[model samples]
Target chain A: MTQPTAAVLLIGDELLSGRTRDINLQQIAQYLEPIGIPVRECRTVPDIEEEIVAAVNALRAKYTYVFTTGGIGPTHDDITADAIAAAFGTGISEHPEVLAEMAERYKAMNTDFTPARRRMARIPHGAKIVKNPVSGAPGFQMENVFTMAGVPQIARAMLEDIGPRLEGGARVHKVQLRGPGLREGDLAEPLGAIAKAYPDVSIGSYPWYLGTGDNGVALVARSTDTVRLETVRGELEALMRGLGVEPIPDPL
Target chain B: MTQPTAAVLLIGDELLSGRTRDINLQQIAQYLEPIGIPVRECRTVPDIEEEIVAAVNALRAKYTYVFTTGGIGPTHDDITADAIAAAFGTGISEHPEVLAEMAERYKAMNTDFTPARRRMARIPHGAKIVKNPVSGAPGFQMENVFTMAGVPQIARAMLEDIGPRLEGGARVHKVQLRGPGLREGDLAEPLGAIAKAYPDVSIGSYPWYLGTGDNGVALVARSTDTVRLETVRGELEALMRGLGVEPIPDPL
Candidate 1:
């Protein structure tokens, strides 16, 4: 069976401006991988309405699932909910259940339910709420697109709530082999031949420099089929041995 | 004058598969910002030829500059150089100078100059070389797009070489005010008013939790005009005071 594919849309000017480093995309990718949905593409666009809407429309159409993080705060720059509504050509207003929850939370904190705080209740019409356990403000899901908060803790909470609902495909298995003191150039020919021999698997070589003297290349092989994956991995080991190098399992 | 805008295309499957958290986008954004160039959008695509070519074409067309990282190493999966050549509809072959440099580096390290290592010397037709001070393999520039290594240190070195060649616009100035023990909802209305008051400046509110019981919001104001930026910052501080909160300068 073909693996399910997903895309991530990270919306924020802070991320693109270098004021904030994004942590949500990596978390989302790792979350989806074991569930058999791999993130195929990820895009980080500014909080502009047109850019957000365009990215949402394009990604939603192409992937089985699309996840968006950021811009769901109670401020003027927080325009993600409205943009998502615009992308779907739907109306948006304060969701009644979400408003009730927010009102209760604010009351417990001895705070007023101001219009700005109420803004968090805004949900695209016909969308289901994705509960945020950390903060009272809940994210919403419209079809296949899951819109969550930009903050790492909140986004992680939202993902935990959404995880059980997803239907996954075959999980991909991966194996790594490290060639210490070996150059990629020496292994390139055999690596290429091994990759060609196993068309079903994806083979990647990554170089690493550990301090001043320690440096080597890591060979990673991934596939959904365990048998084929192991077979290809054995061949990779043999190839490294032929090149006069011992292959060690990557510590990572 | 309008600031020059740029886009970054990060090409690697390891990024999408959650094997590698990208450090290049943030580095690129921070590098370009002080130079008066802001990265407006960034996209990460797996090592697929069509996706890389398509993103290169699209981003290069929209932004003043495009920076692509990864897929330039000497491995079979490193197809970025070839994909870039295809993106510009040009031929690619080993550039003589680059080949000579790689050959010398490999010889000094007592390594063979294998065909795989030679792959790093490939350059698109007519593109100028971007020097890689960390690694012997040089990156290239084709019109508005600057291709660099995936490794952070190498990419950093390439940016150093490319910086002097870029023509920048007005550098944006920014100021920040943090309102301790203040909620975003309370600041939203006044923040909106301030944003409307300074239409040319971009104002953003970010919420933070201090791990203790403390939580507050940070207000950031950005503009190309230093005088206007200061004026807007003062207004923001006054607005916070009016809301019965003291505004502190952000530690960052």
Candidate 2:
């Protein structure tokens, strides 16, 4: 069976403005990878309604699952829920369960459950809540799209709640081989040949900076078939030796 | 004048696989912000050819500039350059100058300039080379799309070369106000009213976790008009105070 593919839609002007560096994509990707749902694409857009609607529609249609982060708070800028509703052509209303949860949490703190705070209870029609352990507000899942918090901690908690429900496909296996003190040009020919030979395995070369004025490249081979992956890795090590460089098991 | 918008397309499977966390989007966004070109969107796609071509076409058409990083290497997975050519329906060939530069660098290092390394010399028709100072392989510009290396250091170096030539637009002015120990629900009503009152200024609220079991929210206002931005900021501070929370000038 084909591995289930996923896409991540990160929403917020803060992300696009460089005010906030997104940690959610990597977190979500790592979380989904073990479950055999590899995130094939990720798009970060500003807090615009039309953009969010368009991205949601496009990604949801293409991938098996679409996860969105940010814009579910009480502020006016938190329009992700609304946009998701618009994308699905559904109406949003305050969910009673979520409202009750937030109300109890706020009541305990002696805080008035204001309209803005109550806004967190608003979810798209027919969506199921993705529980948040870190924050009081709950994320929601509309169809295959999972809308979670932008905060890294909260997004992680939501993922934990959502992970078990997913139907995972084949788990991918990976092998890493590092070539220190080697120019990419030197290894290019053999690496390309190996990639061509092992069509089943996806081979990638990444150059790293050691902060000591020296650089190195790491060769990564990924495939679902363990035998093909190992064969490609062995060839990669031999190629590194051919260039008079020893292949290290890891970069560090 | 409206600020010129740009989009960053990060192409690599390593990024999607969570093998590498992307630092390029923030770097590019920060660099462009100062020059009056704001990055409005960023999309990360795997090393697949069809994905690359589709992203390049979509982003380049939507924004004033589209900056792409990764897949310009010599490996078989490095199909970004070829995909870019196909996106524009143009042919690619090894540019003489780029080939000469790579040949000189390899000769100096006593390395054989293999076909894989020489592949970096290929450029799409009518494209200009964006010089790479760190590595010898030069990135290229096919119209508004600037293709650079996947490596952070090299991508940064290529941006330095491309920064000066860009036609920047109006610089955006910004003001930030922080409200510590304030629930977003409490601040939501006044904040939304303020946002509605000042349509020109874009207001954003970001929640922060202090690692001490306490949360804070930062309010940011951005506009082209400095006076309006400050006026909105002042109102935001007043709104925070009205909600019994003191507004800090900045987060730090």
lDDT of each: 0.91, 0.89
Go through the candidates in order and give each one's DockQ.
Answer: 0.75, 0.69
lDDT of 1 by residue, A1-252 (tens): 767899999999889988888888899999998999999999999989999999999999999999999999889999999999999999999999899989999999899899999999999999999999898899999999999999989999999989987889899889999988777878888899889889999999998988776998889998999999999989989988888889998743
In order, the TM-score of chain B in each prediction is 0.96, 0.95
Q: lDDT at B205 for candidate 1?
A: 90
Interface RMSD of each: 1.2, 1.9
DockQ of 2: 0.69
- Name the top lDDT candidate: 1
Candidate 2, chain B, TM-score (2 decimals): 0.95
Interface RMSD of 1: 1.2
Candidate 2 clash pair list = none
Over all chains combined, what TM-score does candidate 2 have?
Answer: 0.96
